[model samples]
Target: MFRDTQSSWMSTLRHDVPASLVVFLIAVPLSLGIAMASGAPLAAGLIAAVVGGVVAGALGGSAVQVSGPAAGLSLVVVDLVHTYGWRATCMITLLAGAVQLLLGVFKAARAALAVSPAVIHGMLAAVGVIIALAQLHVVLGGSPQKSAVANVLELPGQIADLHGPKVAIGILTITVLAVWTRLPRVFRAVPAPLAALAAAAGTAWAFGWDVTRVDLSGSFTEWGFPVLPQGDWHLIVASVLLVALLAGCESLLCSVAVDGMHGGRRVDLDQELTGQGVANMVAGALGGLPVAGVIVRSTANVQAGARTRWAAILHGVWVLVFAVGFGWSITLIPLEALAALLVFIGVQMVNLGHIRKVHGHGEVPVYVVTMAAVILLGLAEGVLAGLALAVLLALRRLTWVTVRKRDDRDGRTRVTISGSLTFLGVPRLTHELRTIPYGAAVDLDLNIDFMDNGAFEAIHSWRLDHERMGGTVVIDELHDEWYALAASGARTLPAKSPLKAPDRWWLPWAQRRRGAEPVTVPPDGVSECLVTAGTREYHRSTAPLVKPIFTELARKQQPSHLFITCADSRIMPSLITASGPGDLFTVRNIGNLVPRRGSEPHDDSVVAAIEYATQVLGVRTITVCGHSGCGAMAGVLSGGVRAGSLPGLRRWLRHGNHSLATFIETEGDRLHAGALDVLCRVNVQQQLENLRTYRKVDEQVREGKLELVGLFFDIGSARVHLVPPLRPTLCVKPFDRPVVAGEE
Candidate 1:
């Protein structure tokens, strides 16, 4: 325990202390600037900073997030101050903090995140414009008017008659801030705002210019209790909710961003909200501006190597110490410099990156509407307008549908309907269906993801009416069978269920198009043949996709594997191996057998193919694949009783005599597996041995120039298992474990 404590103290001294100093430098100037922009006493900004950092940092869920007076709340704070006196505004802040505390206790933090990001971005951008317009007046050596419109109307006059020293100082401050990032790394080690403010203060002091200085004299000593405002109860309650919600949201959003900046424990948003609430209550009681998480300071804290909440808490302590001990030093700095800083920050809040992000998601309209409404109307009114528009846009997208009608080459009308089939699209759907003439053959393709009862009834009624008019209608659902399910009185699958795999051309015809009927049959009476239908499908679909590949391999065929397997139609070599065209040179037989060299009943056909594949084609690997429930193996176990009638088949059963002898010798008494299954696996090993009996195959095997592989396909489980050479134990376990040719 002692060693752990010692290590923690060492870490705090090494990492947290330096990070705290950096955050302190950043928070002090921003707090002061935001306080000035909000028309509150500069001391109120400092007070909020101290309370936010110390209180919120100690209690908040995020380890490294820094909290303080944020500029995002400046416009709202200034409005509250103007309407209700400063004391009443403090009371509102207090009430807002209590409301936040209740909300955090109830764990409603995640619900706030459901609000559209476009709405939040628009609100922040609009607030930025308001802050910039108001601060521009102070930068121009004039007091700002009541509204953003009034500020714009009086901007031309203020520019014409600028106070010399104040304008020069503000311009110098903005210039230093704008160019500070481009300076050398060593110089930029000092925070840009700190450097700008210090430069402005130094120049002003040296020149002895007559400028407005920050007056914090008696600011800390003159604290009083908050007073309730005299106003309509509805407006007052609305104001409290606004402050609580806005401050809570901004703080929570900053915590989320801070989580991405560092590799640390994720922030508990509910706890973070509670911490912000406590900090705000403290700040309001102490006659400070509203407190919330500030992203700039938090980013600085993380980048400066803060590893814990101590950095944020210590930074706040430093601010409080400086405010008490170095109060006289602040009087030397010009107020115009702080206003210039506010202008720079406010301009930055309208980020182009945010606009591009929202635009990509097709929420640009919501962002623009929200921004315009806030600028023209009030903040609350603008937010409501944005929310309303966002809800409407969502509804429109949810009920969106498309209907395309065309005449196919076979004289059948092809109508494809897609998207969600809600009642909102019923009018357009019925209109399109009505356009189809009576007695016309129609292929109705429903490519919809979801369908409602209204849409199903519309299509069903149309089909009935068309069929009664002597027209044939075939309904094919390309996606989920929503219409067919509704038609058969079965409960349709929910739209939000797990998605099914899309139809692929490689799948069997019966599985690919489940409910699709034959559009047209061939006149030659071969229409029932799957091969004929598959050829037609290839010509229409698969041929186009593989044509380029076929073109490349037109002159020659160079396959990698010589795959020899049973003549089982259930096993597709390419599908099992995940290979494409020209990948496998296949040889299929009744038993997947190999005739031994110089043996009776020798098959020259199998020998010729093996020699050609190994010597001429230069195929490296020859795989002998067998399968479960093989009829040849079953006949072998029955002593050729099934093949007794046919002389040719009885002679062919001689190839498996060696496999039968091996199975009986090793596994006849063991009842672990069925006799037929044991014989089938042994047959694969016997075939591999028969191949080695040839001089060419033996020589290549000895030289390690040729590889012989055995494969067993379990038709029931649809799994492929590898079989080792010369081993009597066929391993039927999963591929993760080792397996032998004859092990079960």
Candidate 2:
């Protein structure tokens, strides 16, 4: 068993490490030459190869992958160097590297893959052509050429004037190696390219081939080490940028591909990015060239049967040994061989079939990525462009809404919508409701809590449209949630959506204005699918049959007062006092606002909460409260409250109004304020006084038992506070006795 279990790991590792050695060997010469072509020191490209293996491998991503200076970058890096100078080019690289690191840290590594495939293919093909054109001089041993068919057209003239013996040696080397590479795999590792290098060097030695080699004597240390340029902040920055982007993109792509192949899911995209960012930072600091997750070596490892990320690490060992031990030998590899390798890599990326699949979904994504990748001349720009397009597409989808209609026993239409009602969806959703018919008794069922601020505002506008259509809209049922996004469903608007008023226009004005609830005659195909879904809250659950004081007060006449309180879902004034209709005028909100406090203009909600309660229902008592875990109390207790998050709520919470300034000062940081019980008492006391700001409310309270009182009801005990009576008048200890069903 030991032998068998160990056999698998040993056999796999042995094959993969050696195979990766071949891939790495292939990568080295290309790296050195590409760096030279890009107008950077040959060592810079070697740095990329070394860093690609060393840093990216140690960071632990993508098994069997390698990284190095890539030919794909030649045109862009070269042009940037020519235009901005090497130092500036390095700075750009540094900036690009930083961006890549950020993407990895943010787990945005996969964002690049979102590019439209057609655009990707088109860009890739364009890159292929660029690569082929740029390498023409080296392949044919001619001078530098420009891009396009024009340059290609002059190839005949260029070939006729080629560096005679160098051209001949290049031709002979290409031929013999081409034939040898075609031989069986075991023989292929005999290093035919190295043999060709020997043959070419021999020809140069035998015949005075005066073609220029790497012009090394211009700069070298006394110790014969290549002289690297002294660092400037600008150059270092550029190098960092280039390294970060190149590494991030290459690594993430390789990781994803490997994951797909083995089904060995290990890397978390975000964490992997974090790791890559750190890796690049280290690599850049050490003066290594930019490194990216290279796919070829990784794939070779996979082909050789790598089971772990370790294969990547091992490949780095081989690179270090070769770079240190064979520096002299490396200088002899022909520029043409490196170009051929790049051509091969470029060809592998054609992937036309993949493009067809991506094109099927839509073209916009492809369009965006294509333009970004090609136009911007760097992977970062293209990847970012692709990400932007994908996000826009997602937002559009969110805004594209669909609506469903359901009915309860009363035959009233419950319009349930599915999808985000974003501002984008507003015009469409608004128009759809116009067809609901006037005089329609529509219960706009916003059982969905999934609406963002934008969506909430959109639905709020619908209230105006509903009223304009001559229809009576009842915001009868709603969810208790406050910050409902489009994904969670919604709470119906009370007159003006969530947190408005119960009887906004008084029952009679609504009755006089539009009858018992206008009848809606569904326009075909709407009636049968009206299946009831979701639950209903009546705001009328009686245990000790605790009733609302408003209901008791409303029984006699239209009461114009609101009791803004906590969301306990109990402590009902209507049931506790047996008031009905317009008796005990009441308004309920988390925190009460009245008689504007602060430099801010008075909110309609404060005016409206009080106005509808006092002016509309003519409520005599305006009760404000803060109960256990009251979010508003927490705001005052914790210094520096964020009013923006809760919107209307933040404004209303200022009702602890004077408490934050006056009460807390006298009490000396002892915020009977943040504490639930203390907040409840403070809320009642503060609100009783604020209610006086409404002249009508003041007049009524002085007029008898209608007097405003402060109460602190303990939720644990289910006790009702009688305030000044200094007694828990409505205490129902569950342990003492089971609540007599429906007893008030």
Candidate 3:
């Protein structure tokens, strides 16, 4: 126990201590800048940083996540300070923290993640624009106007009459920050903001420039308790809820992002929310800014190799020490330098990566509308507007339907209806139904994912009218059987069933037509061939549906993979791969074997197929697939005892002798597996080796022009596992790697 405790202490001193110092450097500059942008006392920023680090770090679920005053909340804080005095804003922060605590107790943390990311990004972008405009004035040695629009109008005049010394300092700070990351590793070891501030302060002091310095002489001495605001109750309550929800969401989102950055314990979002709540309550009571997780500090902590929450806790202690013991040092930094830092941070918040992501998801409209509304109106109103637009877009997609009508080769009309069949699409659906001839035979294919009562009635009424006019109608559902269920007098109201894959033409006829009467063979005749009956079934049910796809591939085939697998009845390559007619060029054999180029009892069949696939067809990948309970593998394991009666089978079994030897040698590594199963897996890797013996395959593989893959199918579990190729010099254990989900 003593040794373990000592080792843990050593680890903490080595990792967390250094990491805390790095985060301390980063948090101080950012916290002060955020506080300045928020129009709050400079002391409040340090107080929030200390309280956030100590309270949130000690109680939060995330191990290395750092918490402090965030730039994202500056706009809200400034507005609150303007509307209600500083003490009233503190009271509001306290109330918001209480609300957050209640929400965390109720386990509502995950619900915040359901909000559209586009809306969140837009909100942050708008806040960034506001902060940039306001701080740009300070950077130019002038006071900012009340609003973003006002600041824009006054920017020209401010630039025309800039104060030389202050502007030079601010410009120097911005230049240093912009170039910091590109500097040498030694120079960049220090945080960029801290280095920039230090450079600006040193330059100003050395040159004896007349510029404004940070005023914190009265901040610590004049601290007082928060007081209730004098405001309308309704607006006050809304303000509290907005602060609570926004702070909780940002903290939880930071926790999620931090999870992806490390291999430590995953965060409990509820606990993190509770921790942020406690930190905010403490900060507010101490006359400081609201507290939440800060991504910049957290990223620095993680990158600095922080192992536990101690890094965050220790950073807060450092902040407290500096604020009390060395308070005079902070007064040396220029206000213009901090303002320049704020402008840089604000501009970065409007990230181009986030814009590209939202644009890719087709949510650019929501993002744009939310950003514009927030900049012109307010934050809460912008969120509501974005949500309303998102809902309308969702509904429009849900009510969309498409109908395609064509004549088949058999002189029958084919009508295909797809997409959600809601009442909004009834008019288009009925119009398409009316275009069909009254007495013609029609094959109606319902390829819809969802259906409503109004859509069902429209189609059912049309089908009855057509049948009354002597037209034969056969309704086939290619997706969910919504129409069939409604036609058979089943309840279609809720329609809340889990999504189930529809029966495909590849399934057996008996399984495909479940609950339908079985087809019987004639009593006077022998058993009919299943192949003949299958082809007839395909012609009647499936051929018409896949005619277009087949037509596109009729003249030529450009399959991407040459799949070679065992000729087991249970192994369906197309079914297992979820591939269609022209996806895979397949070659099946007894043991899924690929013989060496010049081995005994040479077979040209497999080699000929490989050459044709690679040289003629230019196939990209070649796969050797094996399965569980392979009879050929079993025969090879029994030392030719199973194939003693058949000479041809004995010769084929010789090809798997190397596989048998390999399985025996590596038998100890996989004692839990059966001998036959191990041999089956080994055979796949050995076949991959045999394929590489060919000169053309080797050259192509070396040139990166072709890829070889191995697969193992478990018949009972219906799972396909990937097997990597074998290396001759270094023995690699088979079936040891993880299985990834197969692509459709």
Model 2 lDDT, residue 612, Cα? 64
What TM-score do all the candidates reach, one by one?
A: 0.69, 0.48, 0.73
Evaluated against the true structure, the overall lDDT of model 2 is 0.54
Q: Write the number of the candidate with greater lDDT, choosing between 2 and 3.
A: 3
- Tens-digit lDDT track of model 1 for 267-286: 99999999989988998999
State the lDDT at 49 in candidate 1. 90
- Please state the error at residue 739 of candidate 2 in Å: 36
Model 3: clashing residue pairs? none
Best by the TM-score measure: 3
Model 3 TM: 0.73
Ranking by lDDT: 3, 1, 2
lDDT of 2 at 146: 51
Candidate 2, residues 1-744, lDDT tens digits: the string is 999989867865676567656666656655665676566666666656666666666664554455555555665676666666554555455556567667766667677665444544455555555555555566666655654455567778877777666567667666656677788888766455455656666666677665445433322122222223344757545544544544555566656766655535465655555555555454444444455555555565566566655556666667667766766665555555544444444454555565566667665465546544653455445545665666677678656777656654565666756444556776777777767766677876553334556666666666667678776666533333333333256544432233322323233222423211333335553543211210111221121122455444433454443555555465565543444554444555554434443325455556666656655565434445444555555676564265547766665565566655544554566544345556545656665566665666556555642445454555567455544322221232232222211222
Q: Which model is ahead, 1 or 3, in terms of lDDT?
A: 3
Give per-residue lDDT, candidate 1, residue 145. 86
TM-score of 2: 0.48
Best by lDDT: 3
